[model samples]
Every structure is written in structure tokens, then in C-alpha cells.
Target chain A: MTDRPKTIDEIDTPAVLIDLDRAEKNIARAQAAADAAGVKLRPHIKTHKLPFFAKKQVETGAAGITCQKIGEAEVMADAGLTDIFLPYNILGRQKLERLKALHGRVTLSVTADSATTIEGLAGTFRDAAHPLKVLIECDTGGGRCGVQSKEEALALARQIDAAPGLFFGGLMTFPAPGKAAQAEAWLAATRDLLAANGLACETITSGGTPDMWRKPEGQVVTEYRPGTYIYMDRYQIAKGAATLDDCAATVLATVVSRPTATRAILDAGSKALTSDTLGLPDYAELVGEAGARVIGLSEEHGKVELPAASRLKVGDRVRVLPDHICPVINLYDQVYLISGDRVVDILPVAARGKLT
Target chain B: MTDRPKTIDEIDTPAVLIDLDRAEKNIARAQAAADAAGVKLRPHIKTHKLPFFAKKQVETGAAGITCQKIGEAEVMADAGLTDIFLPYNILGRQKLERLKALHGRVTLSVTADSATTIEGLAGTFRDAAHPLKVLIECDTGGGRCGVQSKEEALALARQIDAAPGLFFGGLMTFPAPGKAAQAEAWLAATRDLLAANGLACETITSGGTPDMWRKPEGQVVTEYRPGTYIYMDRYQIAKGAATLDDCAATVLATVVSRPTATRAILDAGSKALTSDTLGLPDYAELVGEAGARVIGLSEEHGKVELPAASRLKVGDRVRVLPDHICPVINLYDQVYLISGDRVVDILPVAARGKLT
Candidate 1:
């Protein structure tokens, strides 16, 4: 503890820094939005992957956290987050055994799109004291995963209801950006179909940071999961969900080389900032450095295309707002939490690299 | 130790698997090529970032290991690697202090492309007993980090030679693919310029995996550093450097869902395989699936485009050859070293996230 840095300037380059004030405000704002919409806000821990932030979200009136994997949920559970929703198809024997162990410790719910995945889950939780809550993941035009049609969703829900140690909870979806209305319409129709089949659909979960602020006017979605609003990125700004000032997380880097008049290199590269352009023009936007863009990245060097009259010199520090912040946060083992140039804390991203 | 996985089938999904036999063959082949070309092979450890594999490379006749950051070099030095070359412009006071400490522990050398970077290195190593070796990094058409012209190289070499506790080692370049000959010619001219200026150029290093097997007929380069030869990837295959059988690293993922007739979802995603397309067609190539390709990736799901009538089921495991192997390797904490169907060893990626 004695060796800890006292200020942001004392920290090393290529480090992820979270503005504590901005992050807290972001958390409170998202919670308020969900409250006003009368929907439970389930903040995805994938954005920060830190228990500190997850607990803050929960304390700020979030219903529960949303995790994409059992490993992430396990981390949150160990940190005393009792409720979690894993919106993924849990498959295979090894993962199912772990899921069962995790289910015993937390009030866990999961989503499945196929009967094979449901069978695996049902076999694992068949003799548990409490039934595992399983949701039918519907492909509401996202086309990534989930059952294709309303008939398919009904079939999976029926399978879950008939399983030995499983209960059909509801329906879940990860809709594409700008397709929330279509996804809500599909989910509503499917809920009706399930009702006609005598299966009670208790919950409807829909999520995406791009559409986080859009209210569910159809009144179909009961829960919303938004991960990146805690630390909005260039992609979120491009989608009009946030502004540059709302971005709380940035990669602090030093100009290691000024190779040419219009080219400068930073210590942070794909390993630090990540290479997820999310269809953006550049890898990242250099904060306060107008016309300078991270054009390319090697494993450890960020090549910046500078303006002709750029004053960026070697040894000068700069902050970069990555195009996508979720994957960037996953790249680091720990991040610095700062407040107005003071280093407040250093939190380890405990759930990072939990690929299982 | 009793809980160790005995075979590949028992290991969890979304795991990085290193084929021991293929990796060893790749190592031996690269070393033999360097030997045939009469140049020292300094393998960059950024590809694997594991001391076990770095030691294996050293045992296979590599002159030294090249690290992109001082943190990575520190990890390798702790593991008893003596000679490490870091080919990045080392900047900032904090990093310089770490570089000074690392220099005291091992035969450490670094690269510089500007006077500011050189000044910091000289200020840190001024009173040391031994002079630090500093190489001038030339752009050589890479357009990344490095001096743009041969004259800039000479100026930096002169500065290094004149500075206290510093020695001008030579020239280094990470050339663009298919531009090796042009880079070599530029280095040859730079070496001639240094010689005419009474500065002795001891070593000239140039490296890239795309042109690993190509010989330097100009006889100017004395060393070569290739990072990706150990785990050849789809990018290497696209460059005609290696075949699919030569690939040593693959992400073993389980097919979690077949959402549509032409789409299947795997457990591995950008968090495991990374989003580095490297100008390739897809995220990864499924090892044995003829027409299956990884089309898109979320954080925890790989949306694989499957061929019609595909047999990939919900529980079947598949191996994926990523487009770029270096960044993908950095995403995992440990990799299973496998020989045929047996899990031989589980090695921690000790330097995977050493961003600074």
C-alpha cells in the first residue's frame, strides 16, 4: 500500500483510468432512466468487470447484474451479488457442473435457445433442492443466437416447464441497434402465443447499450440490460446514446515517438485500447487533440495520424477514448479509479479473462 | 495438481490449445531458416508471452527474445532469460526507472526513434557501470514507429554514441509485408551512412512473420525477429508463409447453438479469439469444418456462419484458427499444451497483459 501512486500523473502509461465522479453520475443516470420507464435495470458487468462498480450499480437501485458467462456471474456472486441473470446458452458438461454449483450460491437465471442446451441444464439441476430458472432466448431479428420463430420459443419454454428441476421463467433477447420496436413486437406476439399454450411468461428481458435510453413503448420488456453506459465510448456516441463528456473510461498513454510531422506513436496499442473499431473510422479518438486519430495499432504501438500543425511531442501524455470500451476494459488486469487528477483507488478487474 | 485435466476432452471450452508437436516443429523450422540465412534469430515473445515457450525458443537456438514492453521483459528476466531486446521507443520517467532496474538484472537493450526518448534513457543510465545498448529504429516503409529517413537514423545513432552510459548498437525495423527487400536496401544504405560518419553499426535487425523464410541477400541484416512463427495463424496463411497444418495454436470452443440452418454460435468470441481480422475474410477458420466460418463475435459468443446441412451440434467442440494469433494469445490467462489428444501441460501466460 505504501508503494501506491498518489496522483494520476504518478501512474504509468497505457493504463485504464475511470473518472470516479463521471462513473457515479453515469450509474445514477442509467438507474433513473430505468426507474422512470418502470423497468428493472440489470447493468451488465462486462463493461467494467469490477465488483466495485457492480456493487455501486446495485446500490444505486439496479435490480441485479447481467453476466454473459457463468464465470462472470461467479465472480459477482463471490463479491456478494446474490442475484444475477446470465443471458447465454449454457452448454456442455463441464460448464453445467459449474453452473449448478453457482446456482446453489446465488439466485441465478439463464437463457437457452435450443433443446440440447436445455437438456444439459435440466440434467445437471434435476436433483437440486430448488429449481433453476430458465428463460427462452428468442431471435428477435438479431440473428446471432436464440430460437428463430415464436413457435420455436414456445417449444423451448414447453421443454423447460416439463424438465425435472427447471422452471420456465420468461423470454430474453439481444436485439440489434435501432430494432427495439421490432424485437418488442416479436416478444409480445410470442408471449401471446405462450399464453395461448397455457405457459405463463413472467419476465421479458431485452438489452443493448445502443438502445439503452429508448423506452419500451409497447410495454413488453420488463427488464433492460445496458453494459456500456457506465463508460460510454465513441461507438456509443456515434449511436447518439452519449456525448464525449459522458465517457468515463479512457486509456492514458504517452507519446513514445513522433516519427513524422503528421505521425505520432503512443505506448498504448491494441493490447491496451483494443482493436474493436465497431465500424468507426479510426481505432480511437484522442481527447482534446483535434484531428488526431489512432489510425492503426500493432500489438503495443498505437500509430496516430496527427494534424499537420500538431504539437504532440515525445514524452507528452494523452488520453484516448476507444471506439469500444467493453472489450478495452477486458484487456487490462486492473484499472485506476481517479477523481480530478487524484488517484482514489486501484481495482482489479477480477472477472477479466474468465473465458470459460 | 490432482485436479489437472488429463486429456483435451476433459478441458473446458473456449480454451487456447497449443499443439506441442506442431509448435516444436514450427520453432525448429524457424531457427533452421535463420541458421541457413546466417543471421541471429531473436524471437519476439509477444506471440506466446509465456516463459515456458520463450525458454523453449531459447533452447531451440534463438539468440535472444524480443519484448515489446519493459513489463514483459521483467517477467521474462524473472524467469531467468538473460538477453532480451525490446524494440520500442522507451519513454517516460516511470518506465525509464523500470528499464534501468531491468538493465541491472539482465542484458537488456532498447530502441529509440527520437532525441527525447534517448535523453530519458541516457538520464537513467548515465551513472551505471555498463553502457546500455540503444538501436535506432527506422521506418523502412512500415509507417509505424521509427525514423523516416536514413539521415534521421544517423543523427539518432550519433546521439546515442555521444551520450554517457549509452552505446549505439545498430538499426532495427519492423517492415511491412512484401517490403522486406526495400527495408533491407534502406538499412544497407543507412549502415553505409553510419560507417562513413565513423559510427560503427554492430547489428542490423529486421523482422516480420510474413517474410520469415525469405533470405536477406543484401548481407546487411545480422538478426531477424519473427514472433508469429511459433503459432502460425490465418494471417500467415494468407501471406503464403505457412499452411493450415503448420498452425500450432487454436481456440477450442463448443458449439452452443445452431440458431438457423446456416448459423451456429460458439462459446468463443472476441474475448477469446479477438476482433483482429488482419484483412482476412472472417474472424477465424474452423479447423475441420469445410464451409464453416466465424462471421461475427460478441463478447462471449462467436456467431459462426455454418454451411447448409452442417453437422455441428449444440455440444460438439471445434477448433478455430484465428486471423491474427498474437493478440488472440494475449486474451487468455493460460493455454493447454496438447499432443494429439492428451493435455501435456497447462502453462500460464505470464506476460500476456503486461501492457506497460
Candidate 2:
């Protein structure tokens, strides 16, 4: 795929362009933050979904890679990633069979909170060569997935221990930023409960890119997974996770139409930059331009309400830092890796659109 | 993809289910509306990028197909479609070279709004064996892309007429809903201006799914392209473009977690139903559940705030009708075609992520 060109200027529009220098710096910065916190770094592959970046993270001292879906884990395994932690409560027989196959291919561990999911896992991996490891997902403050309280966490851990062909690895939670202490306390209490039940948990995982730098000082967790730290987005910048200089990926688009004096349309829209505002009013912020902003999108056209002082015109190429790059990266098959106007590589989003 | 299940109940979670009955009705109903208006129907493939549906539209008496991008047109041509209209201002050398190659394969016509685009088309096809038909996109009331006024359309038409390898085929516009008269008046005025300049235009195309049933009478538009009418969504329901029963696609997701009695988390998130609100507050609306709403998405989990009387529980399979189905369709590689409780067929979204 890198055979397209050697220079960035020759490439087409509506492309996911990553600045390698900024990506490398972002990776190192995240690694250093993890080192300071004394936690094993297992970067989430949901951000890039490319094995090239996953391999780079492993080479940079990452313990393993994190995946959100079975299809993504399958792709990473095909790419020779030996270890993977899937932080998703995979269910149903159709998916469990795929999960079992992936587990056989790699050192796979998955998270679950419900008995139905655990039962499905136990049924699928019954009498396997190696028992599948299961982690209980604890609900700290995100309110999305996980056990609600320490009691629920302990009950689920006991269920995993009793289930056939299953190993109770540990507990994990995706806590909201600023609630690290609360989450750590809950995990610690849950660990105490598990010990009271005559069971010991080996690993405790904590995640969330926003809380990556400030892991609970007590080190209640053994490892951390932060997916969006590789290509920091506007959401990360707004949340004080990373600054604008730390963002690595930008969608390169061309202004195809200028309907009015103060209005222009770009070829990239919700399909390119994504519709995940991450609670922002707009899709993305204009890179290298002040006062100009992307107002809206209609499927394929991004409507830009240009500032009166802006000099953007039709046929002009612009870089837009998306509010969220994970979904945006999943929208394209290939991304151009650039370094100082030179296209260094074009990596395939190998696990893109792995919805099921 | 359907090999995993024998019935709809046994199918996987987070899967796209298309009701074949509703889809067939949508196709026939749209064609009947076009027949009543006495215009050629060229449905846009941007909504359902599957060549199967494109072939269905043509089988139901569609004049041709309209694609938003050249990559879509290429995919349609590969499926043995003879005619395609790309209603986009395609620019850059790489795309133009691909367009030239595609033009040789099918009867391809594209729309242009600027001199830069016209120059690119003319230069690419100057020494070709056949001339390419070009349409001048006029800005009627939809101020996204096109010539702003009648004068600009005439000037671009004149340039198309003067170009060696380009033929000024006609005029086209994607206007605001309920503004067909305004668009017609502007296009009629432009056609008169072109006639006065000794240029004859063959086709006058108007588009928009919202205004499909109400194309301005008296044959102002020779052809119409409506994409969303094939699979109506919540946005269309709110816009009076479709009824609740008109929607054909529904995302089947399992309740993965229940954080509280009043809250439920679905396996389908932004990646399943899409993060696109289309100006709505939530991402998707529950199909049969009256009070349930998809409040937020965190990439893999759709946070649903349940009403007090909601009967949703963990492992319950729910159908979510997205606010917009186009981007949601692009999120999955295969969609299950179902009729009642039977799994009829499986179709791949052939042109799902052709971003180039």
C-alpha cells in the first residue's frame, strides 16, 4: 500500500495522515508516563488497529497489546502479536467460537461481568489445551460496563473460578479520570474479598487514556491500557490528556466548494473525520489555522463556516485534527505515514470495520 | 456470514439486520413516486453501497445510478452497471486518472462546479478515444457545493462546451427540501442562458430524498436521484420524508451490561449505529421500546438510559433504529437479510469503505 508515492503532496485528499515524528514522541511520552507510574504498558490497538504500530509498541517495551473485539484480536494474532487483552464482554455461541479460535492462536485474556458471558466462555473452551483466563470488569465511575460494587465483583470472580475450563486472572475497570483513588479503593477491597473467599487474583488492570499519567499512587493495579494516547485527539487535548502538539493523526482534505464568501465545503465529512464529537460542538479543529472551524457534515461533505478573516479557497488542502481519531482511523483502509512532507509508509488498518 | 446461524434468534449480536419485505416495499414505493412525477429515477448508491441494491433499483425501472464518489462508481461498474452519474466535483490527478480508466469501462458522467475541476476533467480526457459528459452543478437553495448563481453556471457550461474532450451534457443540483421551485427557477433560468449562448443541454437533474415525493411539476427536472428513500431512518421520520414503518435496516444488539436498574449498556455503540446524531440528541432510537434512548457511545458500548417502566435486562436482544443508517451500514462488512424469524440471505457491503 505504501507504493502510492514517496512524497505527501502527490497523495489524494480525505486521507488519514500521521506525522511519524509526533507519533513517536507520543509513544515515548506515554511509555515514560507509564514507567513513572510503575505499571506495565499495554497500549490499546483500537486507536490505530495497525500491526505496524502494535509491533512498534511491543518493541518500545510494551508488555502486550489490547483489543476491543474478537476480529481485531484475530487480525493482531495473524500479525504475530503473541499476547492480547480483549476488554470486552464477548457473548453468544457464534462469537464464542471465534474467540476460542483466537485464544488458541495467542495468549488471550478477556473481561466479563455477566454470568451469561462467562457461561458462554466456559462452554466454548471446555476441555481446551489451556484454560481461558477471565477478568472481572468492575464498574468504577464510567457507568458503561463492569460490576457495580465489590460484592458483585467478588461474586463474578467466584463464578469464573467455579466455571469449567476458566481461570480467574484478576479484576479490571475503566474508570473516569479524577476517580482513580475511588476505583483503586474498590479494586483493593474486591481483592480483599477474593482473598477472604480463599481465592487469589494475580492481575489487576486499570485503563482510560485520560487517567494514564496519574495512576493511583498506591499502584493497586498491575497493568494499564490506554488506547487513544498514540494519536491524541481534540477530546484528549480538551480533557488535558495531551496538548495540540502531541496529536499525531490529521485528516488531509481539500476544499472542493465555496458556496458563499464565508462558507466552504471540504471533501471529508462524518465518514472521514467521524461524527463522534466527544462532546464538542464541531467535528474537528482546523490545524495550523486560527479562527476557522468545521461547523457541520452531511454524509460526504463537511460544511465549514469560515471566519471572515480566513483565506481558504477551493482547491486548497487543509489539515483537520479530528475530535476523535479512533473511529476516524477505522473509516479508512490505508493511512499515509508522513515525516516532514515525505510519505514514509502507508499502513493498512488491518482490523478496520471489525464491528461483529 | 449467515453460516453461523440457522434462524434470526440464533444470529450474532451487534449485527445489521435488513427486513427484506420493508426494503422491497421501499424500492417499489420510491419507483412509483418517480413514475407519478414523470421523471427518470437514478437512485444514489451512497446510502446502500451494495451492488445488489443498485441492480434492484435498475431492475425496478431506474434510468441509472448516481454515486457520490468515483470509487463508488468504479465498484458499480465492476458489477456490470452500464451507466453512472457521479454527483461530485472530483479533482486531483490520481482520481482523474482512475476516472478516465473507469470512463472507458462504463458510460460515466460527472458533475463539476468550478473551473479548476473542469480543467482537470478536460485535460484528463483531451486525447481519449471518447468524450466525457459533464454536468454543471448549480447552487439553488442547498448552499453546500455548486455555482452560486445562474451566471456562474452559464460560464462553467460555456467552458465545458469549449473544452475539446468534454461535452456540456446538462445541469444538476441537490437543493434544499421544499425548494424544488427555487431550484427549478434557477436551473430553468440557467438553461435559457445556455440556450441563448448557442449551447444545448440534454438533462436537468434534481436530487434529495426529502423532496423526492414533491419534485416541482411541469417536468422541470428530467431526472431525480434519491438515496435514503431505500432505507429510511429516524432523521427522515422527523423530516416527514418517511414513516416509522418505512425504515428497513435495524441494528440487533444485545444488552451487555446493566449498571443500574434505570440504566442499560448495549453491545452496539458508535461503531455499530454510528455516532452521527444528524442533529438529534441521541445516536439511535429503540425500535419497539418506546421510552428507551441511546444516550451516549464509548466506541464499544452504547449507553442507554432506560425509562422506569423499561423491561430491558442483561442478555436481552434489542433492535436499534439509527438516526442515520448510511454511516452505520459502512461500519459493518456484512448485513443479514431477514424476513420474519428466518435468515434469508447475507450480503456484503461491497463498497463499504471506498474512501478514495
Top candidate when judged by lDDT against the true structure: 1
Question: How would you encode candidate 2's per-residue C-alpha lDDT over B1-356 as one tens digit per residue?
Answer: 33756677987888998888898899999899889888899999888899999999999999999988888888899998899999888888788899999999999899899998899999999998889999999889888888888788888998998899999999999998779888998888888888898887799999888888884756679999999889889989988999989899999999888778878899898888888877787888788888798998988899998897788877889999999988998888888888887888889998888777
Candidate 1 clashing pairs?
A: none
- Cα lDDT of model 2 by residue, A111-168, tens digit: 8998878888888888888999999999888778888888888888888999889999
Q: Pick the DockQ winner.
A: 1
Largest TM-score belongs to which candidate? 1
Candidate 1, residues B139-210, lDDT tens digits: the string is 999999899888999889989999999999999999989999999999999999999999988889999998
In model 2, the Cα lDDT at residue B111 comes to 88
